[model samples]
Target: MNGENAYLATLMELFGRANFETRRPRTPEAFRLDPIRRLLEGWGNPHRRYAVVHIAGTKGKGSTAAMAEAILRAAGYRTGLYTSPHLHTMRERIRIGGELISPSTVVELFGRLRPAIEADPDLTVFDILTAMGFLAFAEAGVEIAVVEVGLGGRLDSTNVVSPAVCLITALSMDHTEILGPTLAHIAFEKAGILKPGVPAVTAPQTEEAMAVLRQVATERGVPLWTLEGWRYGPEEVAPSGQRGKIQAPDGASWSIRLPLLGRHQWENAALAVAAAIRLREQGWIIPDEAVREGLERVRWPGRFEILREEPPLVLDGAHNDASAARLAETAAEVFPGRRWGVIFGVSADKDPMAILAPLRPLVERIWLTRSRHPRAADPQRLAEAAQALGLPGRIRSEVAYALEEALAEDIPVLVTGSLFVVAEAREAWAAWGRMPMPEVDPIPVRVGGR
Candidate 1:
């Protein structure tokens, strides 16, 4: 029996227990599924007690999973949502019906898991979290669990389930070190969630990526649905938010006003609608009203999130090249003809230039910074790369200070390059009691020639 403070410390210790999430240690060993499977089996297989909606991808995985879970909750079902790489708190990684898992849940689970965890000392923090998610969903009596893959899907700890419907969002080249270097190789790793006789859906993918997905789905005897048949209308962009329409091949249409503003939000929303329609067909009993409410209620912070309006600050966790390019496009759309000052920080494992190239033309100037995360690249190193790439930027060392430096320029500010950067900035904004982006507003038309 522990108090809330002790429970918080225990969670921190559990996170620090694994070198996988925080410290960018060299490839210590191959990712194994057996430990998590065995742990769950020992716990009476709690994961098997509930239906699963598994999602995996290089980008948009978290957003898509959040959307799915929200839809489930809005439809009046008890739902469990699990996402990785917590922005602020470890409890954010586990949610039941749109709320963070209670500290009591953590304390109780710790009590039950101590023996199994102590017995198998090799289980990673991710493994323990996966086990906890299963147990939480089971204990909460959730009807469905929306589980986001922590990394590549095949060997990812969350892949143990044969989901009712599996989803693979837009795939790109992130986590190439563990997954693979090329798009096809990465696609193979993401496609690992496809199971026999289960329906799977994917966003529009590249020829190379699509070929691999089709091949894998075929080999797995899965019925694959492609987003090619889906059409998402362009967002009527606004400072407050965006409104868009999504039409599935089955003629399920939804006009949604999304609060999570960005380039790819509509596409992500469309994917969610498609998955929901499939879930309805599978007898989930979700109605159109629930879908609309779910889309409106869904909040995925740090993905092109508007934090304030005085200087028009945006916090997006666009860490990879594809996401960075989309961020640039969305910024151009939102703030037409307006130059932006960007505060950028990225992980060491990422290619800073790939992220910077697409973003360069959109940025007036850059403030390079390092996040508190150990995987953050050195600010000096990022500044050197930026100058060599002809993108002018200065180093600020700390993420919050860099944000301040960027905000001082009196232009719209963008904090991107990593979620870790946005997470750090968000903590500061919370401390200052800055208001959040308005839920919904119309897009103001901008004329050229400032």
Candidate 2:
């Protein structure tokens, strides 16, 4: 095999023995940081060598992280971005200067990390993957690394970094099985990233959430700010992108053409702009022009993405109630008075009825489907749930067939529910249209409890 295939084969071998990311939560003992702490210490703590912008939230954290990385890169800083559950390839989860890590580099680093991983008992897929990113960033000599929390903040593998600034964006119901069901409980968990005397920022949140965040920041002696004081110009929404003026709390605003659509993105852009300004105050030298340029260049795949034209077919990974509500609202605003067909599937753990209820009024038809994920809800189960909720939908066991049926409706098209479904839908779309999805090396193995 060539270098790329060799690396992929090695990864497959390593992955066969570990747990998949989508499994149900383990006990808190399974989440202890000491293992990663020891592992990183053995590797010389690569995370400590660079500045970090750590982000955690129920929504928009990924977008905020991407925007911050782009802005810093536009300001001439060598930046690294680390996010989780990549859509197409694992390399997409880690990037330096917006470029995915090369295959040779991945193999080379694994040569070094493999010994430590084998010697340690507690290392899992996400733990080792996150460590690989930090080491890669340090090796590439990145000046700033923007890290997104893989799951809940407190015990997530990526929480080991002592960041220069921390951010939380648009908190709501998500990962409730692990993060707790109450809004305040979830806020407290995310706020665990706030270090003593470290500056932090939050997007506008509910009174319940803000109270918890404020109390935690005050107790930790951290400086906390909110985007509520920030403002943005009226957004001109389009199938391609949205144009709006992002205004910081300092009264500085930039007219930007954010390549992502939706009003939620506008709120996310404001958070990113606020973070850029805060970083500037810390002597980062980020100019206003870089902010505009970065916002235009930032690309976060699988979140409110428009894939095809002529009737505005879109893909969004809105898997929860709050996010589904936002997707429904955005669909109405963008394709007003028009019906659309939805290709929907979700995780087995999520409340399918809560997710599908809002989309009922907006969609003309729903082709309920299940992705290839081991934990995806069954299509028949989803159809039953939809019927119970009085939401109309039909079961299509195969994603390709579901897409074919939905597109045959001849209205605007949307593929949503879970990010996993979105990922599969994108791959199916690529095959159906002779397009290209990024090359991924997935191991053929038993998934859970293996």
Candidate 3:
């Protein structure tokens, strides 16, 4: 096995033996910050040692955090990035400079953290992972860390950091059970990361959500910069999916060429750039070249990622309504006038109709499939949902089968709506080691803003 694969195998075994989720899942309601605080205190408060940028939102937090990290790294900062819901391996959650933490490092950290885990057995899976990331980043001497909230920002384990800048990406309905049912409530939860006097950068949000964020920032005496005011025009779009740009914030302009795709990504890149400028204003030497270079070098997987070309296979993890809307918009721009064969799966908790409704018009045929996760929606149920929209589609039991059917249609195939589905598709594609016909190259675009 390759090094990464071998490391992943060992980490999974450790997680299983640790009974990582069994102890905390479906627990009594406790959104109090005390638990995580105590846990980090036990680890000697490693999170406090490094400067941090805390990113929170319903969607795009991971991509935004990643863009910020890449930009910081381009400016010669030793950056640490922490994100959840790993595509293939758990190690993908914690990284320094785009590489997963080493197997020895994982083993050592687990060894150090074992006593704490055994003592409180009630700590959640996310809590342990957050602690691991803090410890790992601290040990690696990371100059700055980009931390993505695991769930709602208010109670997420990563909330320990008093960030340099709190970045809230576009908020939408997601994790409603934990974050609250309404968009405003969810936005309030995300805005919990705002520390006193810490500047915040936000993407476009509903009036209600934006109001909550603005209120929170005001209460905390922090400045809140909205992305709508920072507009960027698409300078150029490469067939490989790169989009060049110029951002206008407060009548001041900065040129950037984002390596990621989609117009939504342009907004994301703008957010990242805005945040970087904020950091610079705070006396961090983030040059304009670093802003442009960092954006061009940013790598965020599974956001409109094209895994193969011939017959064009694309994958996007747009599991929520807002993200689905963005994915639909991107599809319209990238594959204009082309009807795509879509292979889709989503978690049972999501509003599948919200996802299916947007892509319905652009899709030629929809192949519904179940992702490997237990929470995956039943393919039959998903087909029913698609039919509810009066869209014609096929249903298959497994993702591989759905892919096969979509490939047989001899049209561009897009696998999306769930990260789990994308992960499974990537695993299958890698295992086969054979390129599909009409190979589509991944055009990386810049995602997330300052």
lDDT measured at residue 407 in model 1 versus the true structure, 0 to 100: 71
Candidate with the greatest lDDT versus the true structure: 2
Better of 2 and 3 by TM-score: 2
> For candidate 3, lDDT tens digit of each residue in 1-450?
765465454455445432322222343255455666777899789998988999998777888888899889989999999997777656678999777886667667876887777777556556777888899999889989999987778777788798999899888887776678899889888988999989889988889999999998899899888876666756676547655665565686667666677887777777888889889888899888888888878888788887765667888999887788888887777667768888988877777888888888788888888776656778888888888988767888878778877777789999998887887777667656754422211211111110
Any runs in candidate 3 off by more than 4 Å, and if so which? 1-28, 250-252, 435-450
| lDDT value, candidate 2, whole model | 0.83
Better of 1 and 3 by lDDT: 1
What is candidate 3's TM-score against the reference?
0.90
Each prediction's TM-score versus the true structure: 0.94, 0.96, 0.90
Q: Can you write out model 2's per-residue Cα lDDT over 1-450, one digit (the tens) per residue? A: 888688878678556545547565645436767878888999899999999999999888888899989988998999999987777667788899999998778788877888898898678787888898999999999999999998778988899999989999999977776778799989988998999998999999999999999999999999999987778854687777888887765687799998877788888888888888778778889998899999999998788787776576788988888999989888887778877788888888788889888888876778889877778889888888778877668888877788877777677889999887777777788877646765655642213210
Better of 2 and 3 by lDDT: 2
For residues 1-450, write the lDDT of model 1, one tens digit per residue: 447676766665565565476553354246788888889999899999999999998889899999988888999999999998777666778899888887767777876897898788678888898899889999889899999998888888899987999999999888777777799988998999999999988988999999999999998899999888778865588877888888877787888888777758777788787788788888989999999899889988888888777678998988888999999888888877777888988888888989988988878888999877766789888888899888778888787788777777788899998887887788767656675432211111110000
